[model samples]
Target: RIYVFYGPHGCGKSTFLNNLLTRFEDYANTEEGLRYEVVWRLNIKKLKGTNKSAMSLSAFEKLIQVIDPENEGKHDLEGKDLAFDDKEQEYIEVPCLCHDNPFLVIPKDQRRNVLDELIKNDEFKWKLFTEKQYEWVFKEEVCTICSSIYQSLLERLGSPSEVFSMLYARPYYFNRRIGNGISVFNPGDKPLRRNFILNQMLQSRINALFQDSNVINYLYSSFAKVHNGIYALMDVKSHNVERMVELHNIISEGVHKVENLEERVDCLFFALMNPEDKRNLREFPSFEDRIQYIDIPYVLDVNTEVKIYMDIFGRHIEGSFLPMVLENFARAIICTRLGKKSGAMEEWIKDPKKYQNFCDDDLILLKMEIFSGVVPKWLEDSDVKALDKKMLKKIITESEIYGKEGLSGRDSIKIFDQFYSKYAKEDRLISMPDLCTFFKKLGDQPKKIIPQGFLSSLLRMYDYSILQQVKESLYYYNEEQIGKDIKNYISAVTNEFNSVIRCIFTKEEIYVTEAFLESIENRLLAENADPTRRKEMREEVLKKYTTLTLTQEIMIEGKDISETRLFQSLYDRYVHNLKKRVLEPFVANENFRNAIKDFDTEKFKTHDRRIKRDVTFLMENLSRKFGYTQQGANEVCIYVIDNDLANKFKNA
Candidate 1:
């Protein structure tokens, strides 16, 4: 299979390839029955023109002279009489390209029968025969050189068993340094000139066994090194463009012509190309179908981008920034990589203005969350229900076209270094203000890369989120009293006004009146709701009580009224409104603002008992509920109060 991974440069294409190689090696080592061989990484730019030689006795004589420079081998000897000094030692060098697998040394006609007799496992035999990926094992014939040697040895011995005994199997050691099994070629590496390879000891042994046969030596070529293995081209530019053109036949027909012989190359061909480098293959239009191009786009997932930062800068760097601030930085960088408008998003959300408090106008932030495998809770229930399987698939498919533009991976890292160095401090944790300031301070040229109005929307969203966090942390309402209030309101709405009744759920006495119903209704309904709207809301609640809550919950199932779905929905809104107003009184108090700043200091001990207790409880809950440090809690609280965030998002 020929696969070309094309993407923008510095987007971790090479890193992904290296990790894949490591995984393949680990899997092959652990699994003894794996059918694949070692992957050989090759830089096509380093490959030179092909050269071939004849497989004659004179070639072996020339090879013997090269290995035995001291004239240790008999020059006039032929066949069995050919002898060399130190014949027992295997010190002769053989080119890795000339090496062949022991299984390939067998004759093609009898190889399958031999394997069927040897392998006892039925499942493995079934796979080897039936699986498409393993078809090469039985279909591929031996190389021209191995076939010649096997035929010659068989003719001399006249026995298949005797000839097969000479062939032995050994472990293949993949060393990258010497280009043994795994070799990585670079653009700068010079191509080898010498194509002939010989080992004197092995040649002498072969000559003694096959004295009358014509086969004496075999020719070598560069392609043999990666035969039946992986051939990875680093990039398809520069000299590699020519090399890719040269592999047209090998890629199409699984064979390469070397002089008079055809070499069979069953290899997994892989290459990495930049988006611009794709033009290099334009001259050969036929390659479009032969090569499979896999898109390796920029990092769109915010969490994965943060993990990349943590990997480079260390995980401890997260402690320097406030919670979600570091991720927000990553989110900002990823937003630059996304398209400004999304058809899928627009199709799903017809109006982006409705979610101004949660998402940006472009919905890039929402898309980033989805890319990170998160369905944000802020999405409207109707929109959430509309996210069926087909709609989700369209959204995910749109990601392929994005992450191609905007800030590259290298650019993001450099920008993060600058941002971190400026804001990370020892006195206080980094906050949203620092993040906003860093991007705002950039020059106009760099700012043009970011989508317009995104920063303002991001700041608005951050402000709204932190305000809710502060409100939740400060809220200490009584759950039992709130439940009683709801039950009393439901009972009052169902009955006539000015009537006195005892609550069934809370077992508390209540004097039902218009003011009593208005108090709870004020929290559940809009503040500006007119008298008629309030009356309509009361009637709606009463209708629900008579139809579902009163008849089914109380009489049919005998479940508490609070356990009904209608009650839970109202309870959520009541609590949300209460938390929204929890920080109102404290924001107006100057002592509360000073107390948050003076927290953990000696001055905090002198504050009034009630004020001190409230501050302490807020800070503790901020740390316990949210993953905030003491310093982070103090900073967020001060930020919310000083910015008048309560009033800023009062309607939200």
Candidate 2:
């Protein structure tokens, strides 16, 4: 019967209304008639609007600017031509963000009120009595950027359709929240750590962009997005829109020249949507051609339905407006189509099978974009049910629901259930177990109709997948170096194993130690294999209060001494032992054969310059465990014996 418009600040309620109108014309009998609508007439001169603040009233009149979506780069609205005509149209308000403009100097409040009264003709309220249906207008809530002024503005604009006219036709509000706060990520205690971060931040690669403090600050923002994705430093809030335009240019340039993982993925998405970058690139010679996306006009009547398509659903789905370059693409990755471009303009352009610049590894990333939390409104709840079936099949398979090739229909339901249940409850920490079980407990074959939000949510969750990728990255630098890695890992895990073995278990649990002395060893031994169980650490009688740096040691040995590489090795070793240690006490075993099964210690393979250097380095650590000098080992007394329980009791 009618449309009601509302939502959170800056969420584009007005713009939503405009989009609805544009989509109307695009709809045919099948989608239309099925999608009903109404045509309403406006009795405008009679629209008496109430307001209080002098500045607010001026802002209210500035609503006229919503008629022009592209802000006319003016501080004040001294002369703008807009007059009310009683015309019938079936459309709603186009949601738009707040426009930032100075309020008019209207000190004469009484005169303003009188003028308001004349605009409201009492007889006009009776003209379109579906006036009875005004209350039922479609209303959207939870995301309008400016609720304070919306009410007064809504009244003047009259039901949503007229408001849609004002919004689609204009650029209304622009204001941003700005602040200065230094972010401290991953805090640590020791001086070395503090020194590391402090130094890195001082010479921050991100800071190279600015000389002017104001300009520099205006562009500073950081989001620790899915790990290793390109994080952007964009310009937002600069009064000069040129800053935004320029930033757009730099981002596009960076997209092609990506060298590090940090800049590649992050740069791709951040460059497109983030308004934070005060800069927009209007200068690139091929910018428009490459991106194939254009910001629509602020004014001039936009077809309401079509506008809705663009603002609500179109921009996101049409992510890579420029077609993917098919030749460079892997067949499994893209869905290439060989057809002449078809659109209203019919401008012949190539439409690549897949999206732009995509690769096979990026399939997960593309999927992640669907689930990234910031959802657009056009994708109503039902849309989530209609996901691309083929894509869903691939996604389900890729997620490794059972850590395998693909999921059956039954498997998919379970996976979706678990994923929804956990995320619905807000437990976003999905590890391998959670991932494997994400859809294992579902009971229904639910379908998606309005799937935009869910799709966005999935895509957005790419960060989680990115984090999972770090484990595999140990292979990235040297995939076959697993041989060197296995040895290093075995040793590291052994050291940790020794620490865990001494405290809680019987002597039988720790045979590698000296029967008499190394008896009460480290606590890691004899712990239960249940991952959820707490580890009862042993009494660490052998103190290890020390500091070590493998950087210089790594350099001297002629092995790449990257801290990331070293840490990754340590982490991998720990994980493997943690998985298998309960089943076998191979770590810290006296039986060198048992403990070093995979630890290839052949001098040529094992005792390379790097290994020798590391062994010598570790020898210092081993000596410290025995309270001995670096040159020798000092044996200690063992309190526990590895005999039968009854015999041990008799001896005691």
Candidate 3:
């Protein structure tokens, strides 16, 4: 099968292949990934006087010259003694050309009959392989040349047992460099052909056994080298029509025809082409159907692009040297690559109107988070949950046009190098200011891919981000838990009173929890609400709260309750009171500053009783209103002072 990765240049097509090679290498390291190949061994002592000599085969011709070059074509040693290397008096070993399985050497028609005999040995036990796996892997026929060699050996040896004894089968791992089962075909002047080199030591013996002068048959083209594995073709469309036809034939028919030989191939073929090359490929319609096309586009994901940068350069930097600002650079480049979302994309979104509401920055942030497998705030209650991998994939597919236009990963790396070199030379850390200076220069360059709008928008997002950090640094207290506690208390008291009021409304058993009602009324009242007005307000709250619960089914949205308007107004009033009673005093009082100066609770208590009381009230308010624990509140106050957050955001 031929797989073509077609896309624009710099879209990481080559990176994808490199990653695949790495993955296969990892798999080959595993026990189960070890497949077997056959090797023939010849007893050097047995053929002493026979016509067979070490230089008999064409394949051994070169190895012999390299090992025993001084002997030239002729050697004084006779037959079996000719192959004996005085250093190691062992039999000659010849590996199979295609990593051909031992059982596959048997003729296809006779394989079924010989299967039981082949596996009879404990070494070839069925437990090592399942029936289907055995069949799929071993079913391929040996290469034409190897088949000829094996047949000649079988005839010379006389029996299967004799041939088996003269051979060994062991695990073989596929390696691209060795060309055992992996080959890459690059465009060149001449068409690909099978080649064989004769080992001089085996040439004489192999020549005597075969009629052809080309004694040893070893196939050597990119196709032949990867006979049973993988074949990669870079820029395949650049090749001539004849080569294209050959590729088409091999892929569709699973055979390569050269002269009289119809060689069967069990290789996975991969072809890479840029978008323009793919456009030219239309000339060959038949080839189109035979190839599976995959698009290897640029990294549209901010995190993934950042990771690519980090993986390539992060190791060189010291601990935490690469600040969050580096991610801003990545996001800017990614934003340039993104096009506006299509109507098709909108349809996939849970709410098209909701998607429309997002600014480009928000969209980019959401898309980046989605790509990184994180659900954004906008999607929390939406129909398409973050865990829906399929829908997320669909969104990516719909936005494929985005990745085609960005600055290439290579360009980004170049900019990163330039920036690092500039700052690191001056003995300064790679700060956000340094990054911005470099970015401005990049944007100013003529005909650069970084769009003006993209740069400006990214900078805006960066400034906002910095401001947010400043705010978080100042209000370091965890208000989230405090807010939760407030809501929970309101829910508990309201539900308890509602349950008692329900029986009175039904007239079955009258019961009124006046204490709870009055407590809630007091909290809801403003400072200006006098005694007379407070009494009226309390009566109005009871009337509305009881009437709605008894008649309506309320559906709450955000902080609003549908049961009664007073609930929302009351909650707001309590929050306002909390902010005024706690927040104002802390900001206005000098003692509050001293309390947070080192977060010394004992000193805070002694410094000013009024400030201490207000500080305690603030923590309780946060715990009661938001849900922060005492320790959490204290930590927040301490961080704010320790970091000098007030000064950072003082002007802003």
Tens digits of lDDT, candidate 3, 246-273: 7777777787754455667677777778
lDDT, candidate 2, 241-268, per-residue tens: 3323333544554321221112211222
Off by over 4 Å in 1: 31-129, 142-149, 156-159, 162-168, 172-181, 194-205, 212-218, 258-261, 487-512, 526-529, 539-564
Using Cα atoms with residue i matched to residue i, what is each candidate's TM-score against the true structure?
A: 0.82, 0.17, 0.66
Which ten residues in a row are the worst by lDDT in model 2? 633-642
Candidate 3 at 324: error in angstroms?
3.5
What are the per-residue Cα lDDT tens digits for candidate 1 across 1-652?
4798889987888888877766655554454724322212211121111211111235565565646757654554444554434322222222224345656656567777888899987898889878898765666666776666557656655776665555554445444445444444444555556543445555554443344334645445567766755667778776676667777888888887765567777677778889888888788788889989898999999888999999999999999998888988988888888998899999998888999998899998999988888899988889999888999999999988988888888888999999889888899898888988899897685688889888888889888988888888889989888887888888777777777888776777788887787788888876667899998988888888889987888789987788997799789888998887798788899999999999999999989889999999999999998888999999999898889999999888
Taking all chains together, the TM-score of candidate 1 against the true structure is 0.82
Query: Best-fitting candidate, measured by lDDT?
Result: 1
Instruction: Give the TM-score ranking, best first.
Output: 1, 3, 2
CA lDDT of 396 in candidate 1? 96
Best by TM-score: 1
